[model samples]
Target: MQIETGVSLKPYNTFGLPAVAQTLVRIEADADVRRVLGDATLGRAPKFVLGGGSNIVLTRDVSQLVLKVEVPGRRVVDERADAWIVEAGGGENWHDFVTWTLDQGLPGLENLALIPGTVGASPVQNIGAYGVELKDRFDTLDAVDLITGRSVRLDASMCRFGYRDSIFKQALAGKSLITRVRFRLPKPWQPVLGYLDLERKMAETGQHQPTARQVYDWICEIRRAKLPDWTVMGNAGSFFKNPVVTEDQCRDIIGRDPEIVHYPMPDGTYKLAAGWLIDACGWKGKSIGRAGVYEKQALVLINRGGAIGAEVVTLARAIQESVYGRFGIRLEPEPLVI
Candidate 1:
């Protein structure tokens, strides 16, 4: 474990916000994590686990000891008649891992292609897209406890996966560092085309029976068209979560705004489009300081050239307030601030 002091975090996060880590250590393996815990001074100090830094907004310098997870490996650990078990290190790029799975003839992860961040971070947010979620393909995960330096393996049930949430975000938040994740890609892969964008691709291509690679390609295309590339335009993909409302709440909002975009959930709830609400509130393409809402998609808040974390927070708060005042619904941010 190589430790560094006063490390800049601007390039670490996708948002490109400026910040510094007082002490940073690259954890290349599980042993490195244990080593840090074994150290008297470092072990007692507060620590932060950083993955790909895609789903976070650094508002200020991190005073805690930052453990940058860099463990790397990927392989099909087990091949069952029912499913193929693939394991990947926490530090592996999520999109690259998805692509690798497809290359290895593992098709179940195609629908989740192009998501930013690392495999370790996926379970924390239960990252989902194109009608599929991490829970759908998750098998189990291995993590090391920061305090006791003990390793634990958690299955799907232990994960307690919810819509863009998991135990990692709740009970285990900041308590452990996920080292690896395993995926159970079921046999006889079936494409997930229920999402509107995938359906549109089907209509446009005239290919109803699409392969996993086709679905992957289509999702990449759709995301490229809709969301900005974090490398070029500094921004986290979706700024706010799609607020789910009860039947009565949905009807009340529908009554007020007939054109509000929404979708019915399987559990008889309604998921309102946060972007639609923000757009309706006249926030698209608007700016405050160096932060601005993406003109192409109001759901994305962008750092318009050298924007600070505070500017982004200010812009997000204003949008949230306006959206709540207009629609009587609160928009929760998706990214972790600071």
Candidate 2:
């Protein structure tokens, strides 16, 4: 564990805000992880675990030690007749993991390519893109409790997966740092043709069903074109979780705005397309100070340059208020705010 005092977290976070960490520890090796956690000194509680820094925004300087996981390793745990068990260090870049699976002739993760984050943080949000989510392939994760310094394994069921939520993201929020993640991949996959853009892209390309690699490439292209690169600009990925509504609520939104898009939920509910709602509310290109909704995707809030976290949160609230005022639906943030 390499410890640095009073570290500026601008580069660590995708938001590019100048929040400072009271203590920043970058753990690379397994021993390094144990050393940091088991150390008697630097007795910081309520630590913040930062991965690729995409799915989070620090509203203010983190008042505790920030443990930025950097342990990197990848391996195939087992290969059965149809499935492959893939394990990665918590800190491995998520896109690279997808790329690795594709290279290994794995198929299920194709629809989720190019999502920016580390492997450990994926399960916390149960991250989804196009039509695939981490929960679909998530096997388990190893996390350590901050209070007890105890390690534990949480299986898929124990995770309590939901739309952009899990136990880790909620009850254990900012209190556990995941050290490893395991995912089940398929050598022979059940292809997901659920996303409209992907289905249309497949049709436009004159192929009924492209290969897993092809789907991966297409989705990456779509995401690249749709989202602003945080590396070039700055953002914490999609800032708001698409609001889920009841069946009756859906009817109301549809009655008011027939063009409202919705996806049916298994629980007899409906999820309003947040992008559609924001676009309908005319917030696509709205900008306030350095924080602004991405011009292309209304759901994605961007940090155009140097921006403050509070200002960004304010802009997000404004949009949330706008959508709520019009549709009677409340939007919740997807990112972990500190």
Candidate 3:
């Protein structure tokens, strides 16, 4: 375990928000986590597990011990007639891992291409895009308990994955650190192209029967066109989760606003586009202090150069209030505000 003190976390987090970690420990393996837990001085202190820093907003200097996951490795763990089981270190770059799987002739992860963050953070957020969520492809994960330092393997059901959430974000939040994750990529790989953007790509390119690589390229293209590069501009991809509502609630809102963008779910509910709601509320390109909504996509909040966490929070709160007032639906933020 490599330890540092008074570390400036701006470079670590994608938001580029100013914050200092009083104590930061780089955990490269399960043993590294155990070592930190075994340390007399560090063991008892409150801890925060950090992955790629893609899905978080650091609102202030973190006083608790920060464990930066840096575990590394990826491989085809098992192969069978029905599926291919792939495993990756928690610290592995999510998008890079997805690309690697495709390079190795594994195709299931293609639709998740270009998503920012580490593999460990994937299950925590139950990250999804283009109609595919991490839970759909997940097999099992190994995590070490924060208090006991004992490693445990958990299955998909144990994770209790829901829309953009999982056990990691709930009962296991900050209580354990994921070291590795495995995915079951099924055989006869079928492409998931039901999302509107993928459909549009198919129509535009006349490649309805695209391969896995084609789907990966298409997903990358779609995301790049919509979301800002975190390196160039400090921001999380999406600031709010698309709110799902009952059929009656959706119909009630649709009656007043016929142009609202919504998708019917298998459960007979509706997933209203959070970006559309924000844009309709006149928040697109709007700013509060140094934090501003991305002009191209209302779903994103950008740090307009030297913006602090408070500014982002202030801006987000204002947008949330406006969206709730207009739609009668509360927009939940996707990022973990620290």
Query: In candidate 1, what are the lDDT values of residues 1-338, reduced to their tens digit?
Result: 99999999988999889999999999988899999999988999898989988889888999999999888999999999999999999999999999999998888999888999998899999999878999999999999999888999999999999989999899989999999999999988888888888888999999899988999999999999989999999999998999999999999988989988888999999999999999999999999999999999999999999999999999999999999888889999999998
lDDT of 1 at 284: 96
Per-residue lDDT over 21-109 for candidate 2, one digit per residue giving the tens place of the 0 to 100 score: 88889977556656776777755455778888887788888887788998788988888897788899889999998999889776788
In terms of lDDT, the poorest run of 10 residues in model 3 is 30-39
* Among all candidates shown, the one with the greatest lDDT: 3
Each candidate structure's TM-score, on Cα atoms with residue i matched to residue i, is 0.99, 0.96, 0.99
Listed per candidate, the RMSD to the true structure in angstroms reads: 0.8, 1.5, 0.7
Candidate 3: clashing pairs of residues: none
Q: Which stretches of candidate 1 lie over 4 Å from their true place?
A: none
Task: Give me candidate 1's TM-score against the actual structure.
Answer: 0.99
C-alpha displacement of 285 in model 2, angstroms? Answer: 0.9
Off by over 4 Å in 2: none
User: Which clashing pairs does model 2 show?
Assistant: none
Q: Ten consecutive residues with minimal summed lDDT in candidate 2?
A: 37-46
Error of 1 at 318 (Å): 0.3
Q: What is the full ranking by TM-score, best candidate first? A: 3, 1, 2
